[model samples]
Every structure is written in structure tokens, then in C-alpha cells.
Target: MRASHAYFLFVGTLLTAAGYGATFLLTEHFRALGGSEIDTSTTLGGAMAGTLIGVPLVGWYAKKLKAARMGAMGAVSVAAGYGFLALLTTLTPLIALAGFLIGLGWGIFYLAGPMALSERVTDQDRGFWFTRFGAFQMAGIGFSPIVAAALVEHLGLSTRGAFGVIAGATLVAAVLLLTFEALSPQASQARAQTSNWMRALPALLSSRAIYPILMVGLGACVFSGMLTFQSSLVRGTGLEAGTFFAAYAVTVVVARFVLAPMINRADGDRASVVLLALMILGVVTAFGLVYGVPVQIASAILLGLGYGLVYTVIQTQAVNDAPPEHRSAALTWFVIAYFFGIFGFPVLGGWLIVTVGIAGFLAAVLAFAVAEMALALLRGRQTTRKPVSA
Candidate 1:
């Protein structure tokens, strides 16, 4: 793997750190501005809605754009959003525009980052780079809040000032992306893949390669909803939310090193079943945490063990099974499905909470999970029968 590839990805992702972190801050920002909870959700949802348009474009243009170039484009979008936010004093509809731009860049940057890594290294070394990819992403997420908090608390930096700093950093990242040489001509075209994703969409979705990621939609929904709404919910069960999440993140990172290799050794079909069962176990067990802290800790560990490798397994399956020429497009589709779960179901979950209560919401999540398992089983059967060549 090229060191440059890793470096560029780390820097590229770092540029978006504030955008992701801003969502959390935006809630309080909106509240401080006298906006209702509904206003916050709507504003945030507007950002997520950008993925609806952005992801599909990424998928369609996967063949045309260099990953680094795409990342550069994303960086600019995010920086623009940051700049716009930095200039804001009062609430305005323009925040949605800024949010939308950021969201667009989010999809494009992620799509580019993975493909760039793929281009930089040999297949034998792909796992190392992919793991690193997650590490960098996690590092950005983990670092952003800490840094932003420090800036606010110690340096007396306003949120706008913090965003300005981030915006400057993002522009530098974009410059680096525009000038990078990691992607060769062939890689630039993803080996000259098909030009029309619209025609290919139907087959891509029907293919067994897409099945694992489809199941991931369910998992992403749970992850998104939990973090967005229920970050505090576990506290009611006698678990400190921070402690539980810290445990979850630690186990996830650790499992990538210790457990992901085993999943990789296993074929995609079997891997999906393993991941699905583990997530099911973890989520169900989480509800039982009212019994004790032991259960809380156990659930966190199990969830980390399960969800940690879930994406890796499905992502590997999707890329490996995709035609090499169209792999970028396939991965984009996979990512879109992921965002759908993250953005779509979380809102639905919120509605479910209001209508059916937490009990009903939990029931719905479980049912959705069961449906994912059934689909996984069906896909597993088909994939095992007709093994895909890597």
C-alpha cells in the first residue's frame, strides 16, 4: 500500500470531521436559537437528504471521476458549508442549503476514499488499507468533538470560529486531493467500467453481491437511531452512556484486528450469517441490561464484536463480487443503501417512538432485524450455491 494513499485518506476524512460533529452541535445551536426540536430534526434531515441526490451521482460517475478528485470536490463542499455556518448569526433556511452541500460531499468523499485506497494497493493488501480506512474515519470522529470542545472551553473560541479553522483545514485537504498522484490512468476510470449506471442499477440490486449490504441497512438504522436519539436511553437501564459507547468503540476497533481476519477467511455468505446473528444477539442483549452493569458491559462487547466487522464483511463481499470494471459503481450503490438505513429508518424510528412508544419502537427494530436475517439467509443460500469469483 502506498503511504501517500493512507495519508491522503486520513487528511481527506479529517476535513469532514467538523461537518459530522456539527450535527450534534447543531441540535444545541438550534435550541439556543429558540428553535423547536422539530426544527432541529428537519434541518438535520435536510442534510441527510443531500445523500439522496449525491450518492446516486457518485454511483453514476464512479467511472468518470478519480477518487482523489471526488474527495477534493467533497472537501470543497464541506468547506463551503463550514464557511456558511461560520457567517451565520440567526437561524435561516440557508442552513439547510449548507447542510445539503455538506451531505453531498459526505457521500462523494467516502466513495472516493475507499476507491482511492483500492487503487493504491494490491488486492492481497486490501484488508490492511480498508482497516486503516476505518481507523482514520474513527480517528476523525473521535478527535473532532474533543478538539472542538477544547477550542470552545479553553481557547474561548466561538462555534463559528471553530468552524472557520476547520474550513481552512478542509481547503488544504482539497488542494492535496487535486494534486495527488496515487490514482493511475486505469484506476482513474476504475478500468473503464460501464458508462451508464442507470441501466445497470436493476441488475446491481438483484445481484447477490448487494444482499449483504441490504441487510446492513437494518444494522445502520439501529446504529443511527441509537446514536441520534437513544444515546441517552441506555442510562435509564443503569448504564452510563459514555462508558457503554466507549466500550463499544474499543471493542469494535479491537475486533477489527482480532476478529475481522476470521470473517475474511470465511466466505461472504457464511460471514453475513455470522455478523447478522452476532448483531441480533447484541441488540437483544442490550435490552436486558436493566438486570445489571454486567449485562450492560456484555451487550456493549457483543455489539462491538458483531457490528465492527459487519461492514467489512459486506463491503468485501460487494467489491469482490462486483465486476472489476464496475466495482466503483457497485460500491456506490452499497454506500447509498447504507445511508438509506442511516437516514431513512432513524426518522421512521422517531415516529414509531411517538406513535408506538419505546416498547413499540424496540419491537419494530427487532422485527426489521428478523426480516434482515431472513433475507440474509436467502441470499446466503443463493451465493453459496453459485460462488462468486474474487
Candidate 2:
């Protein structure tokens, strides 16, 4: 790998840590401020709303801007958002604004980081590189809680103070990104000539990339539903939420790191179908069968093996399937669809968990998993019939 690639991976890890760390603490921070559940949801919703706006807006202008510059801007936005949260003493509308900044920043970074990296590798090595990058990202998310705990427990910092620390770290990421951009002036200018977003939209929506996009979106829903409500899912089962999460995280990192080459070499459509089936099995084992700690751990491992691997597979397809000039647009829409499911599904999941109980939520998750698998099969058959081109 190049020095630029190494730097991008390091900076990407730090950015993911900052974003997810702050998010992990949001609930506790709001509750500490005497905020109600509604206030907490509102704050989170604000972040989601901001992300929905930030992604497409950034994509629309992606060709005109360098990816590194966009990433820098995103880091600064996240810093500003966390900075605002650190200063807050009361649960107010301003909290929502802060959440919005964080979400918007994350949205831009999320899209720009992968978009930028995708350009750095060839189709032959894309899956390998992406899985490695994704492993780093997952490590960041998995370890963020430990980092937060250290800040509060070992360092004697308050929750608000932790937010400040994260903000400072994010700002450092911004500085590093900008410095890298400055040092590589020519590379930044080497991107394809600017193109209109309207012209690229059709390409992303075409048959070549559309199925991967849809499958990813559905896959996101499966991921969010299972992990986001894990606490609820484990209730009364005598299992700590950490048990499932830790097992899942370890499995994901191991799978991505050790299996990247194999995954990259596999048939995309067939692999997706098998992985999606694993996800379905995970949900069934966790929610459908008798509740037990062993069963929960098994479920986590299944999901880790399934979703962890499938994500990079389909994401790579989305880019490779699109025309070279429009690959960025393809990735942008892929990210948008992903976040939409990540943030949007929880609302429905929550409703189902409340109105019809966990069974309803489980049913919904199974439905999505089945649908995604079906889509993967279809995508495979389509690919077999006629190869797509850039």
C-alpha cells in the first residue's frame, strides 16, 4: 500500500472512533442533563435529518471538490457538533442543532472516505482493500466504548468533558487530512473533470448498480434492527449486551481481515445469497428459537460472518458496475441508502417492539433478510445473463 493509503486508513479509524464514541455517549449525556426520552430521540433524529441532507448535497458537488478536502470539512463539522454538546448544560433545542452538525459531518466523511479510497485501488484489488479498510472502521466502532470508559474512569473526566476530548481528536483528524491534501496537490487535481449530478443519477439507477444499491439498503435494515435493539433483544435472557456485541465485533474483524482475499475472489451474486442466508439464520437463532446465552452468541457470530463480509462485496459491486466517471455518484447513493436504513429503521423497529412486541420486530427483520437474499439471487442471475460495464 502507498503512504497515502496508510494515512487514509489511520485517519479513517480515528474519525470513526470519534463519531461512534460520541454517539455511544449521547443517551447518557442527555439523561444526565435531565432530558426525557423524547429529547434524546429528538437529538438523534436531528443527526439523522442532517445526514440525509448532507450526503446528497455533498454528492452533488463531489466532482468539483477533492475527497480529502471534503473529508476535512466533515471532520471539522463533527468537531463543532461535539464542541457544542460539550458546552450544553440543559436539554434544549440547541442539542438538536449539535446533533445535526455531527450527523452532517459524519455523512460527508462516510461518503468521501470510501469514495476517495475507491479511486485509489483497481477493480482487481478493490474488495481486498475495502475489507481491510472496513475492518479498521469496525475496530474503531467496537473499541469506542472502551476509550470513552477510560476517559471517564481512568482519566477522571466527566461525560461532558469526554465530549470535549472527542471533539479535540476529531479536529486533529481534520488537520491531518488538510495537511495531507496540501502535500499532495497534484493527486487532488487529477480527478475526472467535473460532471453534473443529474447526468450521473441515471447511471447509478441503471440495472448495473441498482440491485447492489437495493440489497445494501435492505442489508442495512437487517444490521440496524439486530444491533441497535440488542439490549431489548437480550433482556430476560441472562445475557449481557456486551456478550453479543463483543462476539459479533471479534467475528467481523477476523472474517474481514482473514477472508478478504477469498471474498474478493468469490462470485458476487452467489456470495451475497449465502451471506444473506447467514443473516436470516442469525435472526432466527437469536429471536425465533428458545432464548439462551449460547444461542445469542451463535446468532452474533452468524451475523458477523454474514453482514460483515457481504457489505464489502456489494459495496465494491456498486462502484465497479457504474461507469468510471459516475462511480462516485454510485457510491454516494449507496451511502445514502445505507444511512437511510441505519437511521430510519430504528423508528419502525421501536414501534414494532412496543406495539406488537419483540416477535413483531423479529418478523420484520426476517422479512428484510429474506427480501435481501432474494434480491441477491436476482442480481446474480442478471449478471450471468449480461455482464455490466462501466
Per-candidate alpha-carbon RMSD to the true structure:
3.8, 3.5
lDDT of 1 by residue, 218-336 (tens): 77776665544443345467555445555666677677667766777776676667777877777787667578778766766776676667777777677766666566566767787
Clash numbers, per candidate: 0, 0
Clashes of 2: 0
| Predicted structure 2, TM vs. truth | 0.84
Tens-digit lDDT track of model 2 for 1-390: 476645654565566455654565565566678853345456666777878887876666656677767877888888899899999988789888997898888888787666566556566776556666677777666556556656877899887898888888888888776675565443533463334545678767775788888888888888877776675676666776557667787888899888766766777777777788898899888774345778888998999999988888888789778888887677777887887777667657766776788888899988988988888887777776332221
Task: Quantify how close model 1 is to the true structure by its C-alpha RMSD in Å.
Answer: 3.8
Candidate 2 positional error at 144, Å? 1.3
Off by over 4 Å in 1: 14-18, 21-26, 59-65, 86-92, 146-169, 182-195, 232-245, 285-299, 320-328, 353-358, 385-390
lDDT of each: 0.65, 0.73
